[model samples]
Target: MQNSSPPKMNATEQAYHGIRNDILTGRLKEGERLTETRLSDDLGLSRTPIREAIGRLILEGFIERQSGYTTRVAHFPEDEAEQVYEIRRLVECYSVQRAARLATEEDIAALRRIHAAMQADTPPRDQAAYQRLTEANEEFHRTIVAAARSPRLTALMTTALDVSMVVRTYSMFSEKDLRRSLNHHAELIDAIEARAPDWAASVMSAHLLAGAARVAARLKTAGSDDGQD
Candidate 1:
């Protein structure tokens, strides 16, 4: 007899992408309980696929499953955020240093284009624009890191980027915050163009640390808001 073929994704992968996108874009708010039946009805899929998707998400750190209870969107734990930032600081600094050494004029030019596009758009203070800008910013950072041409560093940075996205989704920023971020990007680009490895590394480190500080403050503020209810 012929060997049986493995099942394709069917409903599970579809459900997984839908829920994952919702979480990443903040459509599913943090700490919101995910009911299998409700999600099944909404997505027009069976509970089995929804459950499987949730399981996958749990492994990916996007959702948390409690024993004999409902799963929920992952909450922004302050400690986790801090630790991720620390790791990001070290990895990104090294990546920027190497990038500064290896970056070509063409690479710098492409980054400039991305930066200009980011600055032109008046990102609305809503989750949608926030999500768009987040992706754009990731692209900008990825360009710099890619210049380094180190596969190991790239892999580690990619994981950190995912964690960073989770942190950012919970902590929304104001227009002022966005503008400040753009300014920093400009400075980083300038440093890179000057071929100043030390300066580029320092700027990238400070930029990442500043972002961590802002996110920490936002988390505290959000906590206070929750307590008021």
Candidate 2:
């Protein structure tokens, strides 16, 4: 008997996820030219799906088309980063506030479990932890947002996370930064457990803004180093 599990995703979705992951993980390199033929061969798909995937990524702000011929990974614009964080802070704070009001015992417990996983997977150095932590951190946020029960807000927040991963890959975090993030996650979990809506909301806002500031600083430092070299 051929073990018949459900058929996996078709080519277009596979191509989309593969290219998106490469861009998010910095393997594609910001501003590096992308050719459909090359990408199709590399990802082992045909040009049709690869083109469709690139179109989707462009729609998602992960890639850009230029000079009617060239496509490249999108670069992080500092101003755009600031704007994204500002919107994220506002939306996430509101989401967490509602989550605190709505979360049940199960919700709080699940959040704690997600955080525990994050704590356990301490990536050595900041090298690629950004990619590794994406799912865990996303689950942590999604739990709170889902508790709010607002589909519209959840959709918006999902887009925000996608954009954030792009910015995060360009900024390396220090050990102190990682620890601070862990502590903030703990505080958030405590606030949710206590059903402190105001406190949870405030902590979530601070956590996002603080992360944005750190990433922005890292970008600046990287820019200076590049100039020196």
Q: What lDDT tens digits, residue by residue, belong to model 1 across residues 61-154?
A: 8888877877989887888788887888899888888888899889899999988877866465555555566667888888988988899989
Error of 1 at 29 (Å): 4.5
Question: What TM-score would every model get versus the actual structure?
Answer: 0.77, 0.76
lDDT tens digits, residue span 1-229, model 2: 7978867989999898788878756688778999999999999999999999898888778888989879999887678778877887999999998888888889889988888877776653453455456567777878889988899998988887664454353235566776787788999989887889999988998898888888789778767876897
Assess the local accuracy of residue 221 in candidate 1 as a C-alpha lDDT between 0 and 100. 86
Supply candidate 1's per-residue lDDT for 81: 82
TM-score of candidate 2 on Cα atoms, chains taken together: 0.76
| Regions more than 4 Å wrong, model 2 | 1-28, 37-56, 124-132, 163-171
Residue 50 lDDT (model 2): 95
Residue 123 of model 2 has an lDDT of 54
Q: Whose TM-score is greatest here?
A: 1
